[model samples]
Target: MALTDLYDRASSLLERRFLKNAFLPVAVFPVILSWPILIQSGRLDRLAAWWESLSTAGRIVLGLAYFVVTWFFAAIVASQWRNIIRLFEGYPIERTPLGQRSADWHRRRRTEATQWQHYLEYPDEDEVLPTRLGNILRTAERYPFARYNADTIVIWPRLYHLLPESVQRDVEDRRATLEFLLVTCLFWAAFGVADFIILSVTGAAPWVACLCLLVGAVGATLAYESSLSAAMEYGERIKAGFELHRGQLLAALGLKTPGSLEEEKRMWRAFDKFVRQARPADMEQYRRTSAPPTGGA
Candidate 1:
């Protein structure tokens, strides 16, 4: 089975309300996980006290950091809630439409090309995005959905347009990954800070504050994870690139309205046959993604 299928199975299991409720406690395991690190470093108790004293603005900043940290996990749960989430293992293509998928490729490519036009075009703060993105885009254009706007394509030519392209070509798109993880780390940090703050502000026993904070932290962590899973729409886009409108692919592969079980079965086998041979990652034969999406056939 494909990664999408595996994700479907896992999600099906998570759907049982009892399972999700029981699993909620693990969300706050981050607190426990950080115990050794923070305790050995002696930052946990200090943070707890600071949270008690933080002004509303400081709290708000910490809150935002927490949100950022847990976004991906939240996005996944929300997908279950909205019925729009489809986990294709680690890829994003499974969830997006072909048109939008194509558009993203076009947009990324254009961003790539623009930086190459001149030295001034190079962004001072960040290196070009399109070039690194080109690896995935180049791999995706194989399925027919890779077609999109021309203006977008001219920007990121490929992994070999210029010295800059070749140099940045192998770089991984880890910005999203790092940002997601950073926010997750911040969330637990805020909990420890809150524990200290509550004890100081309310004159509560330190142990009592910890117990209350732990429960709240767990609930908050899971809820936040659910929300992030909903918002992190990247992996879906990756899966969409691979699947490429199964209906259209069905037609393209020469299967039509089925009249019998035998015919449908035959077509299914044929799809598997083509899939094994023409996987988009194959990259050698179908190197081109979208040739300006010609106006006519």
Candidate 2:
């Protein structure tokens, strides 16, 4: 098959959310980041002249090539979305001295902040992460465990399947917004570094290079701060999802729903243990009297 046809087929297989959250940012970043550099280097005028000289067929071919290249980059970025999230979450950072120092600073700030009133978006001081976004998300991940003894990391995927369609959409939309902001933050930070290096190497006006760097830095900072709020909203949706659908999760697992909050907590603890350890004995008392209904029935 032709390359464009292959691109079409592959992109069609991805969901709309993936394209919005993963593809659009990657596709737009180059154009946004390159404009100032092109202008400063006097390449913009030459590029325009070159474009005007192209035949109709050449223009079409060039546009297609650009689209394909951007699409390929977007695909790569999309594939790494999970890893990017983990990076933003500051996982495995205690090994590095800088990371350890950052973690300690954030821990102290969180401790001071929570001394007066508990913030929903703040993780426990002991569990504090190096980044604000990380701590916000960690707080959400720990919510179910703290309140109901349910291990959210273990239960969330199954709980998501049990959520109503409307609830699922709400959760997915919030998560997509958070991811978009994070990706934008990374792009702008990269743009700042690349723009500074390229401008310095090309001997562009010192003021111009500094201005571009400042713009990029500001954009990155704004995106990162916005991502903190997005993370909190996404976390709230996760909390709501567990609150509203956890019983459905129990039912889906062929377990009986508990009648009281205390019973529910105990049931969740047992279920979590059974899931993690494959210990059927722990869940024996929680099993439903009747088997869960099958699709064909």
Best by lDDT: 2
- Model 2 Cα lDDT, one tens digit per residue, 1-297: 477965774465456767787778878888887887899888999999999999999999988998899888888888887777888888868558877898898877776775322456577778877777788898899999989999988999888867766786678778778878888888988888888888888998988878878988999899889988888889889998998777678888888868899988988889888878888898899889987665311
Per TM-score, the best of the predicted structures is 2
- lDDT for model 1, please: 0.40
lDDT of 1 by residue, 1-297 (tens): 577965775466444332232223235545655564465446888989989899999999987876565554654543442222112111254235753455455455546665333222222222222322223323333212222211112212321122122222222122233223334434454665666564546565667567646755765565445434332333233334223333333333334543554554444444444455664433222222333233211
Model 2 whole-model lDDT (C-alpha atoms): 0.82
Estimated TM-score per prediction?
0.24, 0.89
Model 2 lDDT at residue 222: 98
- Model 1: residues with Cα > 4 Å off, grouped in runs: 1-186, 202-297
lDDT of 1 at 13: 44
Q: How far does residue 156 in candidate 2 sit from its true spot (Å)?
A: 0.7
Write down the TM-score for model 2. 0.89
